[model samples]
Target: MTSYNAQEHHLTSTTCLPKPGVLIIVVEDDTDTAHLYQTILATRYHHVAVCHSGSEAVARLVSHQGPAVVVLDYHLPDMTGIEVMATCRDLEHPVACMMVSADRLNDQEAGCGEAIRLTKPLGCQTLLQWTAKLVHKVQTAVHGEGPGDHAPENLLIGQSAAMQHLRTLIPRLAQSRSPLWLHGESGTGKELAARSVHYCSPRSSGPFVAVNCAAFPEALIESMLFGHVKGAFSGATRDHKGFFEAADQGTLFLDEVGDMPLPFQAKLLRALQTGTITPVGSTRDVRVDCRVITACHRDLAQSVREGAFREDLYYRLNVLSLALPPLRERQGDALMLADHLLESLAREERIAVCPLDEEARNWIQQHDWPGNVRELENRLRRALLLCDGKAITVNNLMLNDDERLTSAPPPSQAPSGVGIHFSPGRMTLRQIEDAAIEATLEACDGCIERAARQLGVAASTLHRRRRRQAA
Candidate 1:
């Protein structure tokens, strides 16, 4: 381990591109392979360090001296690369990671979908190019320059005041060791904000473990958060290290925090307070050093008031909070983000960068993006794929002129006789309601819940109204 850092280090790329003391850690199990990675990184980036096992790599990460790019091997002597990443969740300064596997593993299988994995039998030039790019991005970010300037398509890309304010707050939150709660509409990039905080903080070298709280089954959440000893349950064949333990010295991003089961909130609160988690079927409590970052689309404060959430837990989690502005509020940002997304999509698909038509750009600007960046990406991706050539027209996005209305007006300001429009548009309120309900239901593919959401009413209300209309 000591010999790893004894080698002479460079601070610039082979092309003389200034990299200024960037540290690139290559974690590999084999001696020859580790040396190969070291040689490749030394050619392109400055200060390369090699580690043989997972534990040694983690130890190197914890002692990180500056901005870094970690090229991790999937299999190791003690723990898997994913496990090591999990352990580094709370690193103070954000580090970029590239997982390498000899066993034909992809990024998803490596449990780090955000970064793609390189297959075994590494390409020296390919590895150097990727790591150099990532290192440059990380260094640029650490120096307090606006990241949006470099990649406007990044999830955090936005020049709007709301986004700028968020950029300022990220470091503040990262500097403090406080549990953070993020509230935003779906697709507004809550997890992005969490990652921003993690990378800006001192714990940026640790794993950044993200879990969709709502994605897990109610019965399994407890075991998932607190590791379960083997035989704790019928299917518990081996001991499991839950989210809390995995996130030690890092950050555990609990997305959809509002959706966590009611019964588990007490246990969660206890762990947050005590900084200790007692695994299932274990008498011992292990101390966990990690920051808890929670996010949800719903109004958690409202949930607390409605008694759906524990007040104590709500207050605890809410000690720090950030409200992400929806895409609609970030003026002109949607178009900018769309352009960036399109460029990337074009590159990935091996096609020319598709230009947006006047109508398409207008649609993007005028329309309210209720689903935020996620929606923007999907729409653009669809347009990119469906486009014939040269330009993506409004039709490419499937945005008919009628759907261009920014938002439905308040009930009081709604147009009269929107339904059926029988006898040249003179209709009773009931008739109009019936027509609107019918149209919305059809648009939602007869999904009552979805129709109700569109209609700004409860699903049951939509159901009752639908029944009455049928009668």
Candidate 2:
């Protein structure tokens, strides 16, 4: 059994009425069936009203002044379910209307609202569950929780404008079958966004296979992507299915797609355009029905312009693009994600849930999460391992700001590797500090205290500077 906490109680209490009257207008001509619904709802709600016709139900709804949920039969003698819903729209009266019908409606035509079509001989449990969810949604909406407050499964946690905009667009994008391109910085959860789209889509039950374009060798790229027949190469032993074959009738995620060689990109474009792929050293071309979702940290358009990536292939993959905002841009979400990760780690480790103190929270929030969610998770994991009591302190979280700053080579060590060169002609103060810190760390082999002494700064100040670098 799942345990319900205070938050869960708060979630459920929105629909819990204290003998509050819920006016139910059942528009069913069948007297026996209407009575059964009336009986079920009346047992819990304070009031229940019955109407035999659509016109009568509309009139009652217009006259009613309090909360109401409507249950309309599809095969009404006068109006159809869609017609009743259209009437509600015309009246400007928002009611939680559910359609009871024996016929199936097209899933795509199902509009937003509490309009659910329950077939005849409905199971009590199923009806109750749907009703409860609908009622809760209505109550939550009425109480100013906002539509976005309801957490849809697969939505990554973040309240930043970038994330909010992405969340709003996800459902719209999921309705289409076009290829989706996810562009983001490295370790920025590109795969998570791809998975979110796949799960939110209609083909959620289908498989989700991922392949890293940069991980595979150039020699095996073709065989790995389009499969290969036995004896195709010297090492070939048996026939093997490739990513496309494995992801048939599902989603195929291509990570670091910009790294894919030009030759492979041409083949990939052909396969995508024709919905057919020929195995390596094989004459047979197999048809595949799979959604292609690709991601890359590099600027693919720039790559195309530079002749490193194919322009036609870029156009093919960029049909539906979603640029994932880096963690540094997603403010407040860092703390939210950190809390969630801490709780999750506690549960997984069977340890007492530890709260991140003010100092720790400040450090986490202020830090520039270059690695994004992945880096945050790693820091939290390390903190959890080092924590002593039910609290994660700044010290417990081994966030090495100096090491983070020095990870990237200085501008002086760029392609030229002779002297520092800034694209805009001058290096900013922060960049200078980062370069200096990198040089110092390199000289001292990551000895922060020694570096601090050499730089004539306090060790604590050096540490704070490193944290600021991370930010």
Candidate 3:
């Protein structure tokens, strides 16, 4: 669960924020999720009321009189989110509606008239982004003024075919309410990708609670995941809601799921299957409405086959899967992300934006980013503190000699397995290209995006080449 730590910097709202008397109605079925929204939005919009059901929301909106914004959950106990919006639309007073759903809701799917639709597991930033937009729009309509120009919007930046495809798939993935498994190497953006999917889906207005399974010890995993009644354990002084309850009607991202203890995996599986969790020291089960997204760096299938992981649990958890491409496989993306991180880090440190020198850029491009985006960010963070605020040079990067040797091939000689054999007047350019494509494609498990990136060619170009060859 995220805390409202930012004192007054409500960047998600207007410059004149925490708009007093600007009533905002939040319609959610889950108490925790409703409260989470209320807590975060309350920072910017002073009067934030949370309604537990569609009927309750309708009742409140009809009786309520003032300029207001509605954050409606798509799925509710009484009626669909659209029904609540329809009710708000018919009211004597007008209210701007922001509908939140678990799935990706297109205009046709979002039949709530003109409501702003967002997907579940919404972070504070995304919520603020949309709310600020809605608030500005309402203010403009009511007072005949435009929302002032703001800084650029943050987006997942990359031109790799893999990343492009991932961007296109996020909306579709966000729309799905099924359990999703994200498997990748360490430093690949599994959680980031999951967050993107969550924010883009219909549930974007709800809280996104992430739990690192590996972070906690095995002895207390259950108590941590499921709430504990007062006096339930050694440290239990009061009743505590666990991660499941906190993420109700939102998303629960379980990172390093493979690390979860085997014995406890059964209990977790039961909760997922039944859609209910029984708190420690309590007999009654509580119903939870949360989307589960699990990620790991291990081979779960191999674990399952070896009996280290339960097959039933694996099947249940792997409803949908997304394999993240490693940074090493994505050509030029490491440097692209490095540049993006440079500006962000500089801004965060309250210093002038630093530009990467030619040497630094070359080094970044050539170095195999084994740690991926996370590693890149960490390196830039160190560089930010070390550099002289003007330009980041090669010395500031401090790359190792061994990494350079492995990443950069001998200048006169081409790397092996790229399909380029330096033979005396033997191979044609077409032959070399074909070999390189074939080798790279094989290395990437037949993924065209990964292959195209490594070869410094567009995926479409590779596709055309393949088609021409086939013909």
Candidate 4:
């Protein structure tokens, strides 16, 4: 395998000055694809190199002088992408890797490494975005600008009295070995609180493995968390280390733990109580020394009372608890967070920060943010993408008439009509309109005439749209 250097081969255009002090290595057996990646990266970086095989990549990375980012293809001729990244651990220097593959790999297939995974047929914009993100992360961590003494305050991102108390409680809570329960509404940054606790604790040097309990299916929860030995089940081709094993000597954050299935709760509690987990199909138990942090938006106590959750697991996790305040409860912090998020979003997107206009500011302050910080962030990001003006206004945020009419909080008392429910930014404009029309029709008991009347559209127009949707 041969390697081409950007500086020696004049791969970069003379007009563009590459960013300093970073090297990018692209590993792809396909010559055309390798050159394409090298050319694209050379636009923003000075040191760009290409290697055709995994063996060549491993050789170059092991002896690389400074910080480097590797763009690796999954199916290499000599070895796989995960095998190549596994070698980086033995390197004397720092390295960040991005694994690109046409086939989506499962958690077991991806391995426990921190390499960012990207599916094939990748867009140019996505490639640049992830590369820039990885570069920033590696640089910050290497330069000591990462988690430090002020990690809690820097990470949690609020200064309200409630926020202050939460930050103060985090360090103290981190000193213990108890399981932490973070209670809050959706988008209140429960996972952020858990991270703050992990960074402040003695296990800061170790891994912080976070898994959403609700994201796992009932059949997979046990194996996904406690691990599995090869031949344990169908598709279990090789031994796999789960979240518990991966988080050894660190923090294991279980977000939305209230959604964990009742059957699996007993297993989780046993692991927590005994500090030993038995992988599926294995007779032996492996001991773990990680702290567990659990968070839920809903009330676990209520779930227990309703028989949806276990009382024993509830008591086991609630030993040390923290209540995260919703954004609406934190006075005068919305504007501050808006400014912070706006700047952060701009920097990540590599765009100029769009200042919030007066009307937008007023709406932000007055409107009750039911979705909390997540909503604000989504709105700001959407506004940045949609805004073409000098400043971000309420209209740019799509908050004025559109959201207030269709997506606003429901009235205090229902009028025996259907309440349309959907998450913002998750649906396209066409989808949202379709949902609104369907809900209005449902509320009108399938009377298209009344639905069209309420939807402010002519009956003929509604019929035409419906016909188009069906076809």
Among these predictions, the greatest lDDT belongs to 4
- Specify the poorest-scoring 10-residue window by lDDT in model 3: 145-154
TM-score of each: 0.56, 0.54, 0.57, 0.61
By lDDT, is 2 or 4 better?
Answer: 4
lDDT for each of the candidates? Answer: 0.73, 0.69, 0.72, 0.76
Error of 1 at 381 (Å): 1.0
Q: For each of the candidates, give the backbone clash count.
A: 19, 2, 13, 0
Alpha carbon deviation, residue 252, candidate 1 (Å): 0.7
> Candidate 4 residues 1-471, lDDT tens each?
223344543432444443466678999988888887877677777788898866556545533545788999999875678766765543324578999888997766675435888888766556667887777765654665444633888878877899999888899999999999999999998877887888899998877766666654477678767877878876465676777887889888888888898888899999999999998889999999999999988988999999999999999999999999988778778899999999877865668898999867866766556789989998898898778747997777764674545433244322233577777889888888888888877766566644654665545557767889999
lDDT of 1 by residue, 1-471 (tens): 213222333323436755666678888878778887786567665578887755455545545535677899887765677766654443445577788886787556676354557786766556767887777767765775454432213448888899988887877888879899998899998878888788788887777777766655576677767877878876455666777787789888888889888999999999999999998889999999999999989988899998899999998998899989988778668788888899877865568888999867766766556678988887787789878766997667754554433223245434332444455567877876778888766655565544554665545466557667678
Using TM-score, give the best candidate's number: 4
Kindly indicate the candidate among 1 and 4 with the higher lDDT: 4
What lDDT, from 0 to 1, does candidate 1 have?
0.73
- Model 1 weakest lDDT span, ten residues long: 1-10
Model 3, residue 299: C-alpha shift (Å): 1.0
Off by over 4 Å in 2: 1-155, 348-351, 401-471
Q: Poorest 10 consecutive residues of model 4 by lDDT?
A: 407-416
